[model samples]
Target: MSDGTGAPVLLRTDGRAAHLVLNRPRALNALNHEMVLRLGEALTVWESDPAVETVVLTGAGERGLCAGGDIRVVHADARDGDGSASAAFWRDEYRLNARIARYPKPYVAVMDGIVMGGGVGVSAHGDVRIVTERSVIAMPETGIGFVPDVGGTHLLSRAPGELGTHLALTGARIGAADALLCGLADHYIPSAALPDLLADLAALPVADAVARHARPAPGGDLAAAREWIDACYRADTVEEIVRRLLDHGDPAAKEAAETLLAKSPTAVKATLAAMRRARALGSLEAVLDQEYRSSLAGLGTHDLVEGIRAQVVDKDRAPRWSPATLAEVTDADVERYFARLGARELGLAGETGEPGAPGAAD
Candidate 1:
């Protein structure tokens, strides 16, 4: 089965298992509006089907399972002066994330390559997350002038210690080992073994198949730097965190400080606060609600526009962020990102057939 448009998403079934392949290899399988809706619909259909014991998701190409959401469309939407397109995209995308998190059956995500931003939203929430040695994961949104969304706060917050804080603020990419260390992935399988693993999944129990294929992951950089990360990123404010990093004088600390400084000040502050608040929240739904509010707030800000312009449009690599300095973004400004959206807030309830199904908000 394919969702038309040259089958941006393709589905194949074997016995009790359904395999989903993201088919836009040219785009690195970046999720677009149509792809998001199609994926959600398929997941919803399989959710209640007794014959479908498991769902396996992977990208078509070797480059990545997904790079992220189609940010170019987002840039176009932002430039078009109506936030409707971006709004619709996020509303559906987030609901998909929620559905995956609450999915009844075993949902297996093969994080094979460059998974970041919206890609993480899809894979991280699955029941069984498989990462290969080639896997590269991150939430590199801050560099693009947006705070991480799609329930990123929930996933990042749950990472051990202050590692989530460090990753969120710096948008650092982590390998399979680090991804495992951060609780984002469950099994580590060598890329060469994935074919046999999938075949086993079709014949054996999902858990048994995974256990049979899983291999020991290499050491992660995050584990060795846990103390340093915890010490620097534990500060209440981004400025204080930077100060600590710079003062620490270690090469890694200085590099981290430089990375944070290059990001949008507004986004950095907002992301730091979101990660902090997410730690206190109990559920993924609650975290998504908060993330929705922050995303909406960001749509009205200048940083997102400038950030995309610098990073994507002009490829300038230098964004003129509003409130360019950390000191200029006061506490109240950061608080505004978390403000209640009231009636306009996301409605995350319901499953496939009920009210608030995927794309209902649009």
Candidate 2:
């Protein structure tokens, strides 16, 4: 079916296996409202279909599985001071994230290339996450003056050591091996072999098909830098983390410090808090509820607009962040992001309170 943007997200079935391809190669298969809705609808149908025992998700071209949600649309909504569209998109996208996390049937995702922001949301929660040498995974919302959403708080909260904190704060891109080490990806298969792997998946058991093609991912920088990452990111706040990184006097630490300094101070602080709070939450639904609140709060801020303008629209690579420094982002400001929305709250569990069910508010 068409993803409502002329680009079609092709869906096909072969015996007990179903394949869903994100089909906007030119745009790197970036998700739009129609794609999100269609994907959720498809998953809901396939979940109960006895003929569909497994689902394989991938992007159409070699560029990537998905770059992210159509942020340009978000930029327009926020610019026009009408967030209705943005809110609707996020609500449905987040629900899809919850459904993927709870999917009963085996769900395999081929994170072959660039996967960032909303792309990470879709693939990271799958039952089997396969990355390749070309895979470049990151949660880059902070760079756009937004904290990681789409249940990113929960995913990052569970990463090994303080690597989650490091990733959330710096928006660092990681390779296949690092993805495996951080629990983000399960297997590493070469991109070329993906076609054969998909063929096997259609003909064999899910586990056996994957086992036949999965191979060891090459070593990456994250493993060697884990000690430093934990050391620098374990601090109580973004400022303290920067201090630790600077004091370490190493190239990686210095680069990380600069990256953190470049993001919106409010986003950095709020994301740090979200990751910490998510650690205590027991469910993905709870994490998404918190994210919904945070996203609304972000929409109320000026930094998101400026950040997107500078980074995506203008390509200036320089954003004039309000409350430019971490010191200027008061604790109260950060706390406001986590506040419950009362009547406007997101309901991932639906009216029946069944998690991953389809009756949620849009």
**Most TM-score-accurate candidate:** 2
Give the count of colliding residue pairs in each prediction: 0, 0
- Candidate 2 residues 1-362, lDDT tens each? 34354556878998779988898887789899999988988998998899999998999876899999888889999999589899999999998998898899999999999999899999999999999999999999999899999888888889889998999988999999999988999999998898899999888898999999899988998878888899988889888999999999789999999989999999999999999988876478878887898998898789999989999999999999998999999999999998767677786644436442233332
TM-score per candidate, chains pooled? 0.94, 0.95
How does each model score on lDDT? 0.87, 0.88
TM-score of 2: 0.95
Q: Report the lDDT of model 2 for residue 106.
A: 95
Q: List the lowest-lDDT window of 10 residues for candidate 1.
A: 350-359
Q: lDDT per residue, candidate 1, 76-176, as tens digits?
A: 78877688888888989998898898889999999998998999999999999999989999999999878899888889899999999999999999999
lDDT of 2 at 88: 91
Clashing residue pairs in candidate 2, if any?
none
